[model samples]
Target: MEIQENAALLLIDVQKGFEDEEFWGRRDNPAAEENITALLDRWQETGRPVVYIRHDSVVAGSPLRPGQPGNDFKELVEERRGKGTGPELLVTKTVNSGFYGEPDLDTWLRGAGIGQLVLAGIQTNMCNETTARMGGNLGYDVVYALDAMHTFDLTGPFGWTATAEELTRATAVSLHGGQFARVVTTAEVLAGASAS
Candidate 1:
């Protein structure tokens, strides 16, 4: 999990919205935010670029509506914003992938010459995973900071149930070994970041 100089941390939807337990239901990885914070600290200390993707949900009554309190960045990210340290860019998206909508992350990444992305944040099987897959298809070296991402339980229309753990495992299985990204634990990611 050695990170290259062009590697940047891409945090997706680490917003206050996800904190609403009733809205998101039961989630996994209670320490995901802690891990994301650690990564942010390391990236800031080392002066590596960090980017944040916010999900500004267009769905009315969604927790991520732009004017809602839940739409605000998580306190951890907020405290670091515009400090010129942790996140050098913040891209907002209306969909599952950060590469879409206005201020597209793909264009920004290319403009910044970023070829490697270390992904961390919420909804492992949703926005985070979508962005990772897109990054891989676009030929960027992608790494999944596994322990730094989390998701909630889901029930399909047919009553099929998937726990957060199961979803996370599926994402790892789908993305590993050059398919999309190599998944690494947050601890491993921290160590690698330090080493780099």
Candidate 2:
């Protein structure tokens, strides 16, 4: 689980929209913010590359609409800005996949010779899952932090409602053991990064 010198952290959509207590307030992935902050601190100290992706809703007047406060990175993330050795790269995207039809994250990663990517973010079943799949298909060594991603209960077409804990655990199970990516705990990631 150790992060190599060429490793990078891809933090996806830890935005104010996802942190809105009034909306998605019932989600059960409570460790997400703390995990993300811990990883951020480790990445900053180690001088590893950290790339942030912010989701922008294409629909006008949505919570994540452009220029809205909700579209910005959350307070925890904003506080760490400009404190790292290098400038933080921020990619804004209109779709679930950050690499889809926009800033070309794959190309950028390849150009940087980045082979390992550690992913942490919000909405585990949506943006986080999509990005991890894309990163795996693109040949990056992907590590998904299980406790560092959050998802809300979702009602499926058959009227089945998945609870928040169900969604989080399901996403973790889907990502772990090589169906898509390796799932690791935040503590594991931080320890590995520190040892690297």
Best by lDDT: 1
Clashing pairs in 2: none
lDDT of 1 at 47: 79
Top candidate on TM-score is 1
Question: How would you encode candidate 2's per-residue C-alpha lDDT over 6-75 as one tens digit per residue?
Answer: 5888899999887676666578768789999999998898888898898888987567877888999999
Clashing pairs in 1: none
Per-candidate TM equals 0.95, 0.93
TM-score of structure candidate 2: 0.93
List candidate 1 segments past 4 Å from native.
84-87
Q: Point out the worst 10-residue segment of candidate 2 by lDDT.
A: 17-26
TM-score of 1: 0.95
